[model samples]
Target: MFDNVKNNDTQVSELVASICRLASCMEGRGDAAQREETLHETLRLTYKLEEALNQRNERIAYLDRLAMTDSLTGLLNRRGFQAELQRVLASARRFKETGILAYIDLDDFKQINDTFGHACGDEVLCHIARVMERMTRGMDYVARLGGDEFAILLVRSQWQDGERCIEKIAHEINSTTLRWQEHLLSLKASFGIQTYDHNSSTTNLISAADDAMYLTKKLKRDKCTLSAAE
Candidate 1:
């Protein structure tokens, strides 16, 4: 990897040197015909060099984005999400500000995969990601923590604001109807919100939120069961 980067850098330097040499040749007091020919060749070389540079830069950018993004949902994967969370946590600690971390798990996602197919399940995950992206603020970070789990890092938000945001996210996810082929699939998500405190560790914060989410899921299921029994 290091060798590849070094080689690319060397190639760029060589191209730049070639351009400079061509410019100097153009400035020489030589035969008019020779100078004219050099000018045409220089122009062609310059265009090709510029094109090469653009392609190289674009490829580097695409690779960087892929490194940080989840292939399935186009959201930050676990590694990327953890990095961003650490940055946010550090900032919150330094500034003595508060933030919210929401852990979201899709309800009955496995059932979707079992009944429909993995492709359909994949579409549902993408739909949920889109809904979270649409509902959250620009500064808020949304990430896929693999499978049907996701995390939202809400910066500079109060506890009440966090609650409201989670509620809105849950509502939007539950309300969405994704039509795949002939089947219309509806989804619901359970989320746990935890505020970042001065003493909060990343591991504890995430675990706490996850536990809260599971509790909520259990309560919801128990309520349904009780209602059915009644």
Candidate 2:
């Protein structure tokens, strides 16, 4: 009887040991599954972060383009053009070459705005911008300098080529017709051309070009008044 009771107690102890070993195996499997789930979540978050960074970079590029470009005409704005001009001038000095600057003012543009309407004036300006862009080379710089004024920077060009370019630009401006609200609007531009010297600073070159443009405007006005009197 004693031996039988001892044998029964031994069997019970073996059974309890087997149950504990099985429980420990299940707990280890559960821990491994939780670790795998955490790893997947971390990978998903990393992917989302990468996508956000790419989108932000694209937005920054778009804004930079907008800042450099004019909203209405799609040409370079004054600031952008000036920066380009400076760069060109620096290159020209390094190469010992000449560049040309043309100052263009739309003749009687304010009258068009006042008589026709602001909308018509805007159309005219856009038309002129397109014409200038079409006439100039890809390397050239064209910009609107506020209101009815525009400027062009021609690099590595001579005086005669500059004159020819301005003449062509003037012809295009004179021939362009803007039709708005059944009204045909004609336009003209007075230009001042100056050749840049290596010795002259950018500001001085711009001033010289501005003076020449004013002189041209004055001459054109005088001629028109004289013709009217005749």
Candidate 3:
């Protein structure tokens, strides 16, 4: 009976050892699986963060462009135009090249607005802006200086080139047709051209261009008044 009891105790100890070993194996596998799942989750989160950052950067770039552009005519706004003019002037001073500036004013724009409403007037301005763009080169800077007033900067050009640009723009504006509802509207622009002098400041150059534009307007007015009298 004693020997039988000792044999039973030995068998029980071996069974307990086997069960402990199995439990250890299962715990090790579970730990490895948990580690792999954690790594995958971390990688997924990292990818999402990078994607969000890229989208934010793209939106910022788009907003910057919109800020520099005019909403009405898709032309450069006054601020952007002024910056370009300053840059060109600085370059001309350094390189000793001739630059030309032209100030453009739409004739009878207010009358158009009064007759056909602001919406039609806006369409006319957009049409003129598109025409001006076609007439000028890629290197030239053209901008709408608020309300039917526009300007062009021609870099490294002679008087002949300036005259050619003016003729092209004027002709195109006069020829372009704006269809507003049932009516077709025609428009004209008066241009003032000034050649930059290396000795002059940017302000002086701009002033000269403005003065020239007024002179052109004055001449047109005089001619119209005389024709009316006749």
Candidate 4:
């Protein structure tokens, strides 16, 4: 919003400068016969300038959106995610509301990239992101925190509600399959959830959720190793 306002102000300043220049030209070389032509020229220039500024503003807005979004999955990027986390935390604290923060990581995502290639890996990520969006409430926030990792914020929801939602999302993601070219790929994810605590700082909350997710991943790996040994 601030950027839009600033850009608009700049456009207005530019227009004013152009008008001043036109006024100077008219004053210095005025001819009663050509006065009408000069006024028409000024109007044409003004319209052109307005059209150019509008296009520039539209481009600026598109670039800003791209900056905030992950190009691969169309989810919020880390910068956008962090900004939203701060906002959600502030609001939760102010209203003494309960919410949940979840850190999610795709299981064996690197292996997929190595085996099938980057294109398939990207498809899987987008699939997971889309599934998450479909499973969560409209008010919830989901973001991609870099390669194969994502975060979710369940605003104004209780611990139980968040737990259930996460379980459903994780289940759906695991069950879903992606068909890339002639190959079929199954997906799975590990999730770590941290319920909102009024006293917890944003850093602590994020750390807790990340730790939980790491633990979950480790346990899964251990189980697989043990089963293979047997």
Best model per lDDT: 4
Question: What root-mean-square deviation over C-alphas does model 4 reach?
Answer: 4.4
Off by over 4 Å in 4: 1-14, 22-52
Cα-based lDDT at residue 15, candidate 2: 49
- Candidate order, TM-score descending: 4, 1, 2, 3
Select the stronger candidate by TM-score from 2 and 4: 4
Which residue pairs show backbone clashes in model 1? none
Model 3 / residue 47 / CA error / Å: 6.7
Candidate 4 local lDDT, 16-126, one digit each (tens):
788778877887775875777777778987887788678767877887888899998888999988888888888877888789999999998999999999988888888
Instruction: Score each candidate by Cα lDDT.
Output: 0.87, 0.81, 0.80, 0.87
Q: Give the per-residue lDDT of model 1 (tens digit) for 104-220.
A: 999999999999999999989988888889989999899999989999988889999888988988888878888989998888888888899666778998998989889889998
TM-score of each: 0.76, 0.76, 0.75, 0.81
Candidates 1 and 3 compared: the better one by TM-score is 1
Indicate the residue-level lDDT of 5 in model 1: 52
The model with the greater TM-score, 3 or 4, is 4
Candidate 2 or 1, higher lDDT: 1
Q: Cα RMSD to native, each candidate?
A: 4.7, 19.4, 19.4, 4.4
